[model samples]
Target: MDDNADALDPTPTRGATRTRTALRRVPFTLGFLAVVFLLGLFTGGLWSRLDRRSWYPEIAYGWPPLTEGKFWTPVTGWVFGLTPGQYLCMAILFGASVAWAEWRLGTARTVLVCASGQLAGILVASVTVGLLAHTHLAWADRLAEVRDVGFTTAAISALAAVSATLRSPWRLRVRAALMAYVAITFLFESTFADLMHLIALAVWLPLGEKLFSRTEHGFWPRTRREVRMLAFTGLLVIAAASVAVYFFPGNSLLGPTGDERGSFWSTLLTVLVIAVVADQLRKGKRWAWWATIAYGVLHVTLTLILLGVAIGTDYATTGAVTVGTGLLWAGEVALLYGGRGAFRVPLRRKITEGALTGTEPGVAVRELLARYGGSTMSWMTTWPENKYWFPADGERYVAYQRHAGTVIALTDPVGPPDLLPDTIAAFTDRCEADGLVPCLFSTTAAVADIAGELGWRSAQIAEDTIVDLPALEFKGKAWQDIRSAINKATKEGIEFRLVELADEPFAVIAQVRAISEEWVGEKGLPEMGFTLGGVEEALDPAVRVGLAIDTKGIVHGVTSWLPVYGPGDEIRGWTLDVMRRRPDGFRPVIEFLIASSCQAFKEEGAEIVSLSGAPLARSTDTADTEPIDRLLEGLGAAMEPYYGFRSLHAFKAKFQPRHEPVFLCYRDEADLPRIGIALTKAYLPEVSAKDLIALGATGH
Candidate 1:
């Protein structure tokens, strides 16, 4: 306990550097057990006999127990195994679990949890067996005769206790798996050891808080509503397993003698129950939570009554199994009752913590992007239409816009590469909470893989054309088209001029505006904006607008570029945005303007220039024949006649730029209709569906 202890906080507050805080003390628990195992190996079966000798007195709760005091059994039993295989198994589990637990909970808590779990589990299991045996229950004979001399009970319990210190959904997954294993073993295996494992779990789960609260953040299902959902989900899982055991002969504790038809129908009913209840739990339906609680109470009561009758009629061979099953049901019942307050939220409304940086989301995100920088779409986040979602640490952000009841994230999250997955999860969680479909739009293939890990699907939607400035030359045969356009513009006295649009003269601004208006007028629909910008966007002083102007000062073609930023405010390159031309002025005007812009950017120390991506335009790849690909292809075809995204892409290809595929990552295909509408709104915020359909029919 010193100033150094303060730095051991793994997830430090903002502005705190993450330091690798090593354990203050080495975990001696595993080392000590290794020594004992070695000692037992060298003792020629002496320690094994000593282990049996000590067990006789300690378990007084068992029948025919020794009167002589052998108080060391509880502690010594873990040290001496009857076989080398047993010792080796215990050693592996003990070493890994103890070391990890000690690192997280520290040495003292780890040792205390393990020791207390071991002693309490054995004593309680022995007592339960001994009481049943005194009453002459059929299956109780084996429990009093068995010597449970292993570290499994303690190790598993310690693992469970330490897991409470972990975060979700990993924590939820681990705890669920551990509970399932113990319950399944007790129901099917029906061994004294299985009972001991359950007892160990039961003992350690509630006692973990006393040992350590260092990792508790109260961010998970600690709420009353969440606890109730946990109860319902837990009960449903156990009920489903119980039904499976009943149907599958030889897997049941009753030794497979039940009626097959009865088990089959019951199992089917249980499965249906599980499906309904689980869905309800996920949706946070309070009525379903209450229904699950009612089911648990009725199920446990009926099982206990039937269990009593079976034992009374001497028909029960494994009464311990029945009792264990009853305990599992009763545990679910207690959990439901305890978490009754947790089921308050309705199906549509969800809870949220709001902004990650404790400031206005947009402002905080802008600051983050300015400091860290991002990919090509990063500048789009600064667009007035977008909102931001950040992870708990505020290290990254998912820039998104709301459309068609879906929260569509614009590209993948931008920030530290390592935090992308967690940031995606946090953003998705926020969307789910707000009752909106979550999706990632225009993400890269690598980013798609990250979303795929979260059970999302990806479809290639567009291809970005980027030119390597240093390697590009208009003199080559491949650049013939671009070369011709540039030479023709030069011969016609059309000069390439790069200027700050905001700093330009009023006449120049009026000319650029007229060219944009003329270009929109021919499209037969309203001017588009989201990922596509217009004159207003070009007016930013930081943006470099390149114009192809004739000697008489008439603007022939205009191209605006957004600075692709690198670290520390350095400009990496520029992305082409507003590319427009006066129809009567120049036929090869766009090509001339793009070629001139590239040369200017190249001369300014830029390495590459992105002609930008054409939305809904994808190159054919044999491997990418998914249903979404076809759907997007058809959609692209329908809009191509009017929007000409493909035509735009083909036009950009005249520069012979390298193409990079862009993807749309989403959670489910069912959201495609909404996603489609959202994408339309995002790209053409000013255009209406009626106008789009009219233009599509006209085929202009």
Candidate 2:
């Protein structure tokens, strides 16, 4: 009878199954919201302010209510809000935050956290107000008699606790935003609700890591990017607070305000100066960091003098605005001190630029590569964006880019293989002497091993797809796609040609540019740089270009191959770089071009054809991956929709190439954040904030 019933019902649909799972996961959140809604309806508080109601005093929690022996107010107050607007906000915020917490911590634990947080916020805030009420501070005395209702504090605490469980980037991002919100509101508004929020956040944000988190917790900024962002946000917050004081100047936690605020023109000038410093801080400028530190110290010193005078005379006329601004300045000073290492970029022209003649670095790097062959990616080191670092002997050089106070070496050093260790050591020593973090990105296993021997950590960041040309043939099921593409191209009258791009006719070059532009136009992001090249790189005479052209002389697709040098200045292989095709002209032209290029290179005695590694794309064997690896994987997933890097990686598998791992080697895991940002800057040098926001929206 059960089997007959199961057969009749069948399995639930995916959407239904997901809905059931979601409902099961957030039972406490749902129940709490439902109870609050019922209470609001019963008390007529859904459309009206509960505080104005006759029965509010009995249920509201605060110092005055607690002193009157209404201990149960803590329990009753959480379900009510002072105003109808607050009720709406409470429902939305509490539902979203608690639901997320329940999803992470489970229903039982989430209930415990929410309840504990709510009770603690109310009792702690009440005790604090009661203690400070007799201290003659106007702000405290005023708040002591105020009663508040709502569970917003619990939502904030729950979110703060969950923040400890997050990984890099998000962990830092959430904590920064939470801290900024609480700090800003408490200092400026100083309302009873604001005090509750500040108290809850202060309790949970630090202690919750021990109580709730399973991951390692450290308060320090992990990446250079985090440091710059935090510093920038701190400066901007100070600027914002100044604007608030000048424009609003309402009662605040520090004291009463209004009379002590400076002239409007002076406030505007201060804000403008802070705005400029904030932008410079975002760029990790040394001058900006020092200037901000000096400004903070000076402001705090002056405020302390004023505070001393007021305290001594018992006049108490310094105002809350000065005290609040002083606290923020002190905070900014501490933040800048903690992250001082990130702000080393000089105010003058970059030290790396034109260290030699303008073209000397690029020319010297290429000559060294020819003298002693490096990894497949070595040719990319000669790109114009790179700055070369030559040792004292000048026998070898490392091509690198300085960004975010870090020196990121590209590929392997160019020189004799025997001098690899010395080259690595020299580069490391130079970075240390220069007070820059050292990193080696997109390098081979040999370089990674050398870095590991020197106590550096290495993680696979990409896989170089290589097709061995000597044994290459299109046969069997694996080569079915390539063979079909070739046959289709033949029938379609698409001819393949290998030539120097610069040698092509003006019309042909223009078509290639148009085709490339069209492909880039579809992505809605700036063209990626770093190891990724474009038509300019293809224009090099040494770089070979393969084209798929129809009988009508229309270009269907184009591929650029960088020459991989062997010993004795011989070209042993070709590494694929730029790959672009006409969106409307060719369907399988890429496969046709790659297959034809392989055959052409094989005829020319090249040992292999490299399809090149896709950035952030990894193989299936993810065993024993580190935290940094997982972070990169998540980043890759987020970017997959916009760039299709993983899709491209998968597409290369059609050629049946063997995967060789390329690694990012660094001195410490803590540097991954800065390195990640530097890599992003290197890739999308032209990408704007608006472009990134648009990309993020598209990803969502």
- For each candidate in the order shown, give its overall lDDT on alpha carbons: 0.70, 0.83
Question: Lowest summed lDDT over 10 consecutive residues: which window, candidate 1?
Answer: 59-68
TM-score of each: 0.48, 0.58
lDDT of 2 by residue, 4-32 (tens): 99888968989999889888999888888
Cα lDDT, model 2, residue 218 = 56
**CA RMSD for every model?**
25.0, 13.7
Q: How many residue pairs clash in each candidate?
A: 3, 0
Residues 223-293 of candidate 1: C-alpha lDDT, one tens digit per residue = 22235446666766676555755655332334432433245676688678778786776554667767877
Q: After superposition, how far is residue 79 of candidate 1 from its true place, in Å?
A: 99
Q: Who wins the TM-score comparison?
A: 2
**Residue 273 error, candidate 1, Å:** 61
